[model samples]
Target: MTVFGCRSCDATLTVPVSRVALPVHADQKYGNRPGSLAPALEPGTFAVNPLPSGPPWRRWAELEPGEAEALGWYAPRIRISAGPVGQVLLAPGDVRGAVIDPALVSDSACCGIDGGEPNMVCATCGTPVAIRIDDCGLRQAVWLAPLTTHVIGDDLGPHPVLDWADLIDHRPGIPPSEPGGGWHPMWAAAAGAALAHLLATSGGEPIVIPDHQVADVFRPTLDRLAGPGRTGPERTLVLAGPGLPDADGDLALIPQHPQTGELWPVAPPVRPVPLAWDAWRHLAFHRAPKPVGRSVPIPPEAPLALLPGPRFEPDGQIFLSVLARLPEVGQPWLRAIYDRGRPYSYTFHVF
Candidate 1:
C-alpha cells in the first residue's frame, strides 16, 4: 500500500483555482486612474503612433530678429536634477554660476522628501522641505535669493547651478590654487579634517578665514619646526574660529599629513594661539614682513618643479606641501578653494 510514486501519477495532486479573470479595460489592467494616460495614447492600446501632422509649428515671425539670432546660437543643453526636481537648459561651459529661478519653490509640503534632521524646515519655503541631491554629480554653489525663496521650515534650499566660466574669474571663500581647478586631493582632505577638528572641538562653530592669510601666520612657524634640511609636509591650511579649544593650553597642536598619514611635530616660531579669526588675519596679512632683497634673485632660465598639493587628515591638521617656491626669497602665491556647499572654486593670491 505504501508505494512511492509521482504526485500526479498517484492522483494526489491538487491545484488551486482563481475566480478572478484578467481585466479588459486599459485603466483596469494598467491600474491607472482616468485621464492618467499620456496625451499621445488612445484608449485600450499600448502602441504609440506618430500624428499625421508634423512637428508643431511656432510662428517665427513673432520673434524679434535679435532674439531669433540669439536662439540660433544658444548654448548646448545640460540636464540638471535634484531628486524629483529636474530640468534641461542650454548653458555655456564658461558659465560662472546658476541662478535658481524663484518660481520652482513649492508652497505646499512636498511629501517623500526627507530633510536630514527633524525640525529642519525648507530653506526656500517655510515648510519642512526634503533633502534633494542635485542632478549634476558635482557639488554646486547656492545663491541666497532662490534658497530663501523656497525654504521649507528650516531646511536649506538647493544650491544653484554654476556657470563654469564665471567661477574661473571670481574669488571663492577658500580659493583654490588654480583657476577653474580643484586642490590636490591630499590638501583638500587635510583642510576638511582641520575644519572638522575645529567644529568638534569648538562646540560646532568653526571660523573661516582667507587661506593665504592663514598660511602667512602659520608658514613661518611651521618652517622653524621642520628645522634645517627637513622639508615640511605638504599641507592645506583652513581657518575656523569662535569656539575652537585653546591650541597652546586646552588643546594640543599635532600636525600630520592627510595622505601619507605622517606625523609632524608642531615647531616653534609658529605658536598656537587661541582660535581668533581676525587675529590670525592680522598676523598673516597685515603684519607679514616684506622681503628685503631685490626679488631674491631668481636664477635666469632655471627650471624648478612646484611643490605638491597639501594633504588632509581625518583629524584636521592640514600638511602643507613646501614647494621649491620659497616665500622668504620670492613673492610666493597661495590660494584656497571655496566650496560653497557644492564644489565651486575661486582663487585668491597672497603676495
Candidate 2:
C-alpha cells in the first residue's frame, strides 16, 4: 500500500492493493504528487464550472452535477465477492473514497534521547547559554562498533599531499582514519579546484570562496565566464587554516575588469584523476583487501509493483492513479528503472 497527501487540505489517501491488477492509469493533474483513481465528472453535470483560482482540493465540491456523477461512478472500491483478490468497485458513495489523514497516522519511527544542560556561559556576566546536542549516544555507539580492524603501519608520514593520494588509491577497501584524511596542502589545492569548478558550473551566481588568496588566482577565468559589463555582487571568502578570519569576518577584492565588473574568484587547477600507469601501480601495491557486500536480485521488467485506478482529490474530485511497489534493499536500483520508464507513462496510466 502507498500513501499520498493533499497539499491544500492535508488530506492523505492510501491505495490498499497493488495497482498492477487494475486497468486504470496514473494522472498528474494535481502537480507531481500521487494521483487518485476516481474519474472526472462529465459535461453538464453541474450548474457552474468548478475551474476556480483556488487550490485543487477546494475545487472538488464545485464540480458540475454530471461531472460529479461521472466521478462518483469511477471511485475506487474493493469487492468482497472475489475473496482475497477482490474486484475493484468504482462507486461514489463508498467511504473508502475518503482521503486518509497523515497527521493522525505515524509514518516512521526511530530511537534517541533528550538533554537539558547548558554548555556555555558568559565569562564576566555569567549568563547561561542554551546548547543543543543532536546525536548524544548514537554517534559514539556506532564509532565503538566491533567492525573489521586495520593495523596502522609505522611508515605513515606527516605530508598531506602524499597521504591524500595514497588514501584515494586505497579507498573502497581500507577505511581512512579521517573522513577526508588529515588536512594537507595538496588537499587544500584539490578543495580549491573543486570549489572553482562548482562556481563555474553554477550559472553565474556569486558564491562564497573559502580561500581568498588562492581565489585571487582564479578571478580572470570567472570574469571571462560571466561575460562583460556586469557589476558583480560582494561575497565573502574564508581561508581554511588557523589565524584566518572567522565566519563573521568579510574580506573584499576589487574587480580587475571595471567595465565588465563581474567580480569572481580565481580558478583553481582541477587536475583530472590520472589514469597513468604510475597511478594504477600505486593502487596495485597498497590496496587493502576489504570484503564487499553481496549483490541483490534485479527484475528485468518493471522493478516496482504498480497499482491502477481513477485518481481523485480530497474535495471529492477524480483523476487517474498508479502505484509503485518496491523492494526494501533495491530502492535506488528500482528508482533508476522507473525513471527510464517515464516515457511510457501514457500507456501505463491508461491501461
Candidate 3:
C-alpha cells in the first residue's frame, strides 16, 4: 500500500493504495451507452504516471540540449496514444480532502467526472495533486500528479517487459466499443503512431504495407499521406518482433520494453528501427482486435487469460520521452511526423 501526499504541506491526500492490473485501453471512452464495466483498477490498487496534462510544454526546438534533457525530453506535442501504465494506483476512498477544480471539468464528462485531466486538488492546501476519472460507462480512479503529489510506502519497483514470444501467445480480451462502431481507440492510436515511425523508417521513401486487418486500419493514413506524385524514401511495416520469425529483406520496427520503455536493440545495430512501446505491441500482439458486439464461449482448456499490459498509446509522453533520447530525434522527417500530430488532441486524421 502507498500513501499519496501533497508536496507542499505534506498533507496525506490518499493512502493504502495497492497496485492493480493496468486497463487494456487508456483512452477508452464509455459513451452514453449503458452497462459499461467497472473501473480498470480494483478498489485498492492504483498506478502512478505522468501524462500530457498540466502546464503547456515548450516545443523541442525551443529548448537547448541541456534544458531538453533536464525536462526529460518530453516536448509539448499532443495527440498521445494513451496514458502511461506504471506500478501505481490508489483507491478512491483512500483519497481524502481532495477537491475537483471546476475549470478543469468537461461538459462531455459523465456525472461531473473528468476522464484523466489534472482536475483534482488537495483540500488542505488547494494544490492540484491528482486526476480523478470516474465518468459513467468508464473506469473510475485517480492518477496522482507527479510534480505535486509524492508517494509514501514500499516501492515494488518496475516489472519486466513481456517477452515477444510470451506476448505473441498472450492476447487480451476486447474492450467495449463506442456505441456507433469503430476500431478500438488504443488500436487506432497505435496505428497512427506506428505510421509515424514507419515513415521515419522509410527515410522519406515510398513503402508498402501488406493488406489485411492491420492494413485496413493503417492503409487509409498511409495512402492519404503519400498519395499521387509523392515520392522519397519508403519501407514496409512488417510483423517482426522478439518471438516471431526473424525479419528478412527490408527493415522492421521492433518492440520496446513496456516497463522500462527501452526499444529492443537489433543485432548489428543496423536496419530494424525501434518504434514506441504500444506501437510495437500492437503489431507484435494486438494486431487483430477481438470481434465486437458478440460473445463466444471458450472451452475451459483454451488459453483465454489476458496478459498484464497497461492501457497504452504509442505517442504518449512515455514514447516521446524515449524518442527524445534516440539518435533519430534530429531527423527532419521524424520531427515532421511528430509535429504532424495535432496539438492537445488524441485523434489523428491523415486527410
- Tell me each candidate's TM-score: 0.18, 0.17, 0.58
Over the stretch 102-201, how does candidate 1's per-residue lDDT look in tens digits? 3443333232211111222233233322122122111111111112122112221122222322222231222223343533222233333343233233
Candidate 3, residues 209-236, lDDT tens digits: the string is 5524345445555666555455755456
lDDT by residue (tens digit), candidate 2, 262-336: 222333421111111221132224233333583864433322211111211111011111112112112343233
Model 2: CA > 4 A from native: 1-192, 197-203, 206-212, 249-351
Count the clashes in each prediction.
60, 34, 15
Estimate the TM-score for candidate 3: 0.58
Model 3 regions lying over 4 Å from their true place: 1-3, 8-53, 56-111, 115-128, 134-141, 157-181, 210-213, 229-234, 268-349
Considering summed lDDT, which 10 consecutive residues are worst modelled in model 3?
305-314
Q: All candidates' lDDT scores? A: 0.24, 0.24, 0.53
Task: Specify the highest-TM-score model's number.
Answer: 3
User: Between 1 and 2, whose TM-score is larger?
Assistant: 1
What lDDT score is found at residue 289 in candidate 2? 32
